[model samples]
Target: MTKHIIETVTFRLKDGVKPADFAKSATAMNAYVSGCTGFIARRLSYNADGLWIEHIEWQDMDAAKAAAAGIGAPEGNRPFLSAIDGPTVTMTHTELEVSVN
Candidate 1:
């Protein structure tokens, strides 16, 4: 059976970065990821506490891992990575074992 992979990342923006700029950067990153093999979907959201969250879905863990290896290399991803406060970043990936709906 094929396993689904979900990658979640929580982060805060660096000082001096604006939300509008970050949004544009994220859009670029989204486009880049969309072309990757096995990419399913992606969502960007924020909380009232100033944390930004990114949820990405992949066909499987291998695809997710492959994409991760190039996260810092693509030009389109630079803005998104540079805008993030590195120290505040937290990321995790999991395989879907159960689902209801």
Candidate 2:
């Protein structure tokens, strides 16, 4: 079987944007993400330092890359994107090394 691809995005919220506010946008963006081809699952978490991490699993790298490139276009993603401090964002994609249920 082919290994799945995992995409990790780390970012901070824009100044004055609260976590709750970001969540609402994330919830809305979920619909757009779920509709994308090869999307498998997504998880969002935050650290005490106010850093947010988003993990998305895709069927393959192509899907992950494609989704990342188009994520900003959907209306559902607008608020989510706008809530982020763009310069603080970092993203990476890696082959799934191992996973357990």
Candidate 3:
């Protein structure tokens, strides 16, 4: 069954780097993630901890993994990676118990 995957990526901006300089690349990455086949929905957010959390919904776990493998540099994620001090990416699968919509 289709499920939601919350992929959180933490980016510690370089000593003199600002999130603004990397916004475009982040946006591009998100656009690619949201446009992939089997993508149902997505949301990206920033936290005071200096990490970006991207929640993505895919048709299934297999689809999610396939899409994630494609989420690296080839998709233009190189800039984002270069602009960060330290970054970590992880994905979590969520089972919905109930939904109003």
Candidate 4:
């Protein structure tokens, strides 16, 4: 079986950026991502302490990598990227293990 890939991004919003504004960006980003090949699911979450995390699931590593390489090319993603505190952004990709499910 082909294991899926999960792309995790954790970051902080730029100073003065509201959560609602960030949410709007996330919505736009999801719209663009959903149209990509192998996109499975996407979820964005936050906490009381002001941290944001986005999880995106793909069919495999290649699909995840392909989407990431061109993520900055879309205007829809521009707001989302711009709203983030660049230095605080961290990302990871992990293969899904069925045994853990």
Candidate 5:
């Protein structure tokens, strides 16, 4: 199986908006992304600066794209545009090779 990684970098939250406030929205995103076709596993991490990291493993590239396209946009993402300190960045990659220990 091939693995796909999706890195999400979000700007800091604006005044009156806390990351905690968007916890519910985050969960919805998780569910939405996890339901993708090639989805095998997923991991999410965040930093104080609002940088979010996501690692997802898929069966193949087609599956990954299908899943991501289906994810669309969730309400939580609005905070990034309106109240976040900076713009959000996303990077996606498909594995060409991998190693296991």
Candidate 6:
């Protein structure tokens, strides 16, 4: 059976970066990823500790891996990358095993 893939990235904004700027970059990043093959959905959220989390859903592992290669391209990701504190970023990928909702 085909399994869904969840790609999560957690990071903090670079020093002196404004939330508005990050939002704009994120919106562009979302729009770009939405056009890739097997793209499902994506959401960006933050916690009180000032760390942001991006949750992206893909049709399967293959799709996620394929898209990962282009994540740092200048097309729509440069601004987003510029806003992030690179050293603080952490990413992981997982296959959906079960879902209640």
Which ranges of candidate 3 are over 4 A from the true structure?
1-11, 73-75, 84-87, 98-101
lDDT for model 2, please: 0.92
lDDT of 4 by residue, 1-101 (tens): 88999999999999999999889888988878998899998989999988899889999999999999999999879999999999999999998775332
lDDT of 1: 0.90
- All candidates' lDDT scores? 0.90, 0.92, 0.66, 0.91, 0.58, 0.88
Residue-level error in angstroms, candidate 5, position 4: 5.6
Error of model 6, residue 74, in angstroms: 3.8
User: Per-residue lDDT of 3-101 in model 6, one digit per residue for the tens?
Assistant: 899999999998899888899989988767998899988989998888999988999988998888878875678988888998999999999787665
Order the numbered candidates by TM-score, best leading.
2, 4, 1, 6, 3, 5
Two-way lDDT contest, 2 vs 4, winner: 2
TM, every model: 0.91, 0.95, 0.69, 0.93, 0.61, 0.90
Residue 59 lDDT (model 6): 97
Mark the regions of model 4 whose C-alpha exceeds 4 Å error after superposition: 98-101
Q: What is the lDDT of residue 14 in candidate 4?
A: 94
Error of 1 at 6 (Å): 0.5
**Candidate 1 at residue 48, lDDT?**
76
Give a tens-digit lDDT track for model 5, residues 25-71.
55556656666666677665678666666667777777776765655
lDDT, candidate 2, 1-101, per-residue tens = 88999999999998999999899899999998999999999999999999999999999998998888898888778999999999999998999989887
Which residue pairs collide in model 6, if any? Answer: none
lDDT for each residue of candidate 3 in 4-47, tens digit (9 for 90 to 100): 55444444666676767777777767767776877877666677
Q: Give the runs in model 6 whose Cα sits over 4 Å from its true position.
A: none
State the TM-score for model 6.
Answer: 0.90
Tens digits of per-residue lDDT for model 1 on 1-101?
Answer: 98899899999999999888899999989877998899998989998777999989999988999999988888879989999999999999988777654
Angstrom error of the Cα, residue 44, model 4: value is: 0.3
Which runs of model 1 end up more than 4 angstroms from their true locations?
97-101
* Alpha-carbon shift of residue 44 in model 3 (angstroms): 1.4
Better candidate number, 3 or 4, judged by lDDT: 4
